[model samples]
Target: MFDYSEIRQVTSRDNPLVKQYIKLRDQKKYRIELGLFVLEGARLISDAISEGLRIEYAFVTEQAANKYPDTVAGLMKASIIGTYLIPSSLGDVLSATQGSQGLYCCAHTLDKISAADKMNTVGKYLVLDNLQDPGNIGTIIRAADAVGIDGIFLCGCCDIYNPKTVRSTMGSMFRVPLVDDMDYESVISLLHACGIMTFASVVDADARDIRRVHFSGGSAVVIGNEGNGLTERDASLCDQEITIKMKGNINSLNAASAASIILWEMTDEE
Candidate 1:
């Protein structure tokens, strides 16, 4: 096992690896080139390990090594390649977190889910149409994972690779299959052909109440933008439009919150 003590200490900001890390952290190109992304904190690291991500190197503070020895030990054993004990100051520079958690790692970015011959039949799936908030996307991902949704479609929205989305997911980004570059028409036709009932989630349309809808077959729910909701084009594609009956005075629900409610109702028991 590699000792936690001996790895090269990176103090200078000019260190090549540190420079690369900064680039990857700040820009998207480096992440794509290295096929890697940075993950911070103990919880996210643990989740990455659980997802079987290949962690090439880990940087932890000595305090973390002592305080979370078991976590450090797992990081040591599971990170067959190596581990490093970085200075707290150095780790602070390396960390993307608002508050450094004493642990950080470099792991390959989640592999893209290919579109060709994509599996059409699924127990449950979600389609995001022009949803702009990264946090909302991440929360939807976590909800999808919790409710046993097969995958997600990010249609005409923000990039899934955005760091905020990854962080918000709490590592569900690693588990859920997501496709971003999808066309609306193709998505509708494909799901329809596979016997999946596609439901568009919107407010006060001639839509059915979510409680009344049957989730008996392969199912996919479509959620729209936070500001504008679903486009008329995407909305027209759904076999049905569904809405959660909100008793409160609010006219509509936030896209992510609404999605979680519907997903729980549709897939939680199943």
Candidate 2:
């Protein structure tokens, strides 16, 4: 257990740690440089603690610390570096969410999976191509976790550590293994080398129906961007182009929705 007496209380926004929090909340480059990302809200912080993620620091509003003593104690115990108390007003300024949950933590970023790591795993996977929305990426990660995807390969997607994305994952972000920022060609080569058949999700008449497509061995289903779908070049690299069947003028689905359907169909669950 953490010693409550050791908690440092900071009222000034000019505090060095507070400044670092602001930078981490706003800039992706800062997070990259520090190799740390900010997780806000009690639930997310608690999730990080439960997952045994290395927490560099934790900051809680004074009011929250008082109201939730047990939670504050838990955070203090989980914090490897230290825990600090900030004024509620300062908490509002530091918060990315609208209401300000009064709890925040800084955690080390998970390393991106390498080609060697990808080659060792053989199971269903999801490939995201140029997906821009943080929420969509997070939601997809959550769904991928639910359906037992072996891994996720992100090509030109938004930062997975983006606060919105982190919140949307509801802690699944910590559970999922992700390969970040690879080009289409390299990903395809790696998949093929691993003997994983790739299926491209497209909206074309020539594409095979998703239901009819056989997922025999290790497979990958690719989901494209929100507006443009997959680039022609990327779509051409896959073993087969597949589409979810639809009717009544509804030809497309949101990226997350489409991925969920594809993941469900591809899932080996009985």
Compare the candidates by lDDT and give the number of the best one: 2
Candidate 2 structure quality by residue, lDDT tens digits, 224-264: 88999998888889999999889899989999999999998
Superposed by TM-score, candidate 2 places the C-alpha of residue 127 at a distance from the truth, in angstroms, of 0.7
Tell me the TM-score of each prediction against the true structure: 0.89, 0.94
Q: Candidate 2: deviation at residue 11, Å?
A: 0.9
Please give, for residues 1-270, the per-residue lDDT of candidate 1 as tens digits.
435554545557786666776677777777767887777788888888888988877777887777777667777767655677778888888877777788877777777777546664756888898888989999999988887788888888776666677788998988888887677777777788888899999887467999888787789889999999988778888998888887768789898899989888788557
- Taken over the whole model, the C-alpha lDDT of each candidate is 0.79, 0.86
* Model 2 stretches astray by more than 4 angstroms: 1-4, 118-121, 268-270
* Candidate 1 lDDT: 0.79
lDDT of 1 at 40: 79
